[model samples]
Target: MDESAIRTQLNDAGYALVQVEPRLQGLGSTIRPDVLAWAADNDGVLVPWAVVEVKHRQVAGHSAALRQLATIRDQLGTVDHYVVIDGEWFRADRGLRTATPISGPVSPANGADGVLQDVSLATSLIQERLWNAANRRRHDGQRLDSLELFADLLPGSLSGELVARSGHTVRADRDVLWRAGRRALTAFTSQDKNTDLFVSHPAIARAVAELAGDAISGTVLDPFCGTGEFLWAAADRAVAASRSVELVGVDFSSQMIEIASSLASAAPVPARAIQGNAYSELPTDVDLVLSSPPLGLRLPTQHELLNGTSTKDGDLASIDVAIRSLRSGGRAVLQISPGVTFRANGEAYRQFLAENVRVAALIGCPRGTVPGTGTGSVLLVIDKLPPTKTFVSQLGEDWEDQLSSGGAAITAAVAHLDDKTAKAT
Candidate 1:
């Protein structure tokens, strides 16, 4: 009936008590539970088991205690059983149904056997099996043929609407899927020292969208789009401007391409994603280009720049591709490595820009703004026209605040470019 007795009961039930009043990291805040325990299978593999809340007597606060235990279970990232002890009586719930009486000591047996098991444990095992099966299919160069199949394979807790409108399955939430995809890509790219998977900053992506202005229409492209951050931003800008826009994103990794496609499909504007080498294959004559391509690497042999006996760095190669893909008078916003602006090897690419495009602005991003790397970047805005006075600025420590004003600065500079071009005509 008391806390000590409950602990003794759990110990006798083959559950190892991990901690009393344990603090767990939740989605936003830390959650504290009365008791944390683990259950070991026949092979002695310990898994998270239950969270217990002990109450001295049945009172009006029992409902609140139940709710608190439920929150802790949800935050634990698994269907761990939540047990409540009210004197001699105890009940357990896995968030699937009402708490039921769990008399006597708990059992460590999981749902692997043919016998019926706890609802929560059974659901968790089923989901894990399905996930493993899906992964195996993917490894064998196959995919789930239908959403219904995926839904049927899913546990009852997640059986409804297996696939969202975005093509994201109910197997995981967007944030979970995003993190998993990123980890997979990072691991894949880690095999080659020359390869890097850089995720764009939300602040910078928003700034790029703001700088694109309200007049943007027609086709927008992100040839090296990783997870489609720029595409989402561009879609928002197009919606705000009341312009009909078509967005296209390309990435070399199939996983990244899949995430990008799902995100694009969920956007308000018309968008699509392609999985391929951005340098070798991309749509042409785009009205606008927004991208943050991988840097500090040589262009792969399959790249168009390297194919014709021209070897360039990855960043410069991406810039060249962006330039060639843009329509006449179209604009491009590129996030390039800092070396591209000052390195002697980059001078030829700079000269190419000077001769073929109008340099609008180069805004230096502060260090630590990009994810996974501390390397600074430069946002280069170029228009395919004659040269003009380029506005240059370096963001200080308060770079986010500075980037917030980027739209106004870009607007004025674009107006000046328009005025200069008109006079020249």
Candidate 2:
């Protein structure tokens, strides 16, 4: 079925919000399920209510279409699913349980026009296209060099090959790429999907950026900046703070640096990414630092950057680097493992922290905050100035809501830090 017919049937069946041409997952190849929907009078804060697959009246392969709908129904774990063929509605839910034929109502409601604009989904669609094109080329024996596919698909760098999904190379949307660039290029370049650790939630990036920007201003650096999400958030936050900020992102991955550089170049601030060992790239003049560096890493040599504190722990070393990189009164917002925060063996480090480190706040994040992983994590907001009181709050399962809301723990922590800064000044 056409886009309008699909929308009409969904509206007839009571779906108000719809997303078209979504790269519905858990399938062999890309499957365009036509429209995904939420109930009428209930965009309901964007909770999806049903999945629909629309077929044109004269569409062929009736058996394959039903299989597709059944797979999507099972994949999404949805109770309501439909295979609308030739204007007839067939429910695919029973197929998941038994050999039941597709069943449902033949009806039509009020629906909106065009596709729903979602940053996350739009970026995923781009990601799928880039991956499919690259995979096709790779399968065709095209040995890519470094970030060949990424370099080409980027704005102004589109060689047409990477942008061509099926037939001809079409116009690529630079805006969608910019918004969807939260994930590393490795997510598409890798032999498999990126590990959860590489893909962090954009909400966390925004929260950390706000925390850092609200506290300090001169220059913001993310040492392990993958795809520059933290820096992107920081630079975007700079617009409202009315500050002409400088952003610097460093990473060992060349692909990450290339993509980060491309994304940062379009920012309203002076932003860029440096490719090198992040530990060696920390500058002393930076005013603020924020990042979710790699977890569970170990260094061959001990690090002593955070006011002469020495330790071989990888993340600890990263934290120390962020601390030392700050100016005297500069601050940093970082994500560190929960175990490092409280350990019987860490009493010596605790003493060191009490004497040397000036922690400002500790906002514990809910599980899955690290993305694609089960590892527990928390945000550590600190100042390099002097010993100070630290605000503390633990987020429940509704971490995203708490992080985004104005009255949340992150906002309160910023207030505490601001108050502390005022008193010292």
Best by TM-score: 2
- As a TM-score, model 1 comes out at 0.56
Candidate 2, superposed: residue stretches over 4 Å from native: 1-125, 134-152, 155-177, 180-195, 305-309, 421-425
Top candidate, metric lDDT: 2
List TM-scores for all candidates, in order.
0.56, 0.65
Alpha-carbon shift of residue 25 in model 2 (angstroms): 19
Off by over 4 Å in 1: 1-196, 301-309, 405-425
- Note the residue pairs that clash in candidate 2: 1-55, 1-56, 11-109, 12-108, 12-109, 90-103, 91-103, 91-104, 196-372
**Shift in Å, residue 290, candidate 1:** 1.0
Q: What's the lDDT for candidate 2?
A: 0.65
> Taking the tens digit of each residue's C-alpha lDDT, what string does model 1 give over 1-425?
66566666666665543346644434345567676655544544344556677665555345666776777767763335545556544565555345566576455565211221223333333344455656777789985532222323422323222231122223333333332333333333333333334457767877777666642689999988876777777776777678999999898876666556655654567888898887778888889989888867685463444224365578878888888888888888888898889988767667767665678778888786666676788888878777776777787787777776444555554555455454221
Worst 10 residues of 1 by lDDT: 111-120
Residue-level lDDT of model 2, residues 210-293, one tens digit each, is 788465467888888877878888877787778778898888888778777887765667888999887765667788888788
* Prediction 1 global C-alpha lDDT: 0.62
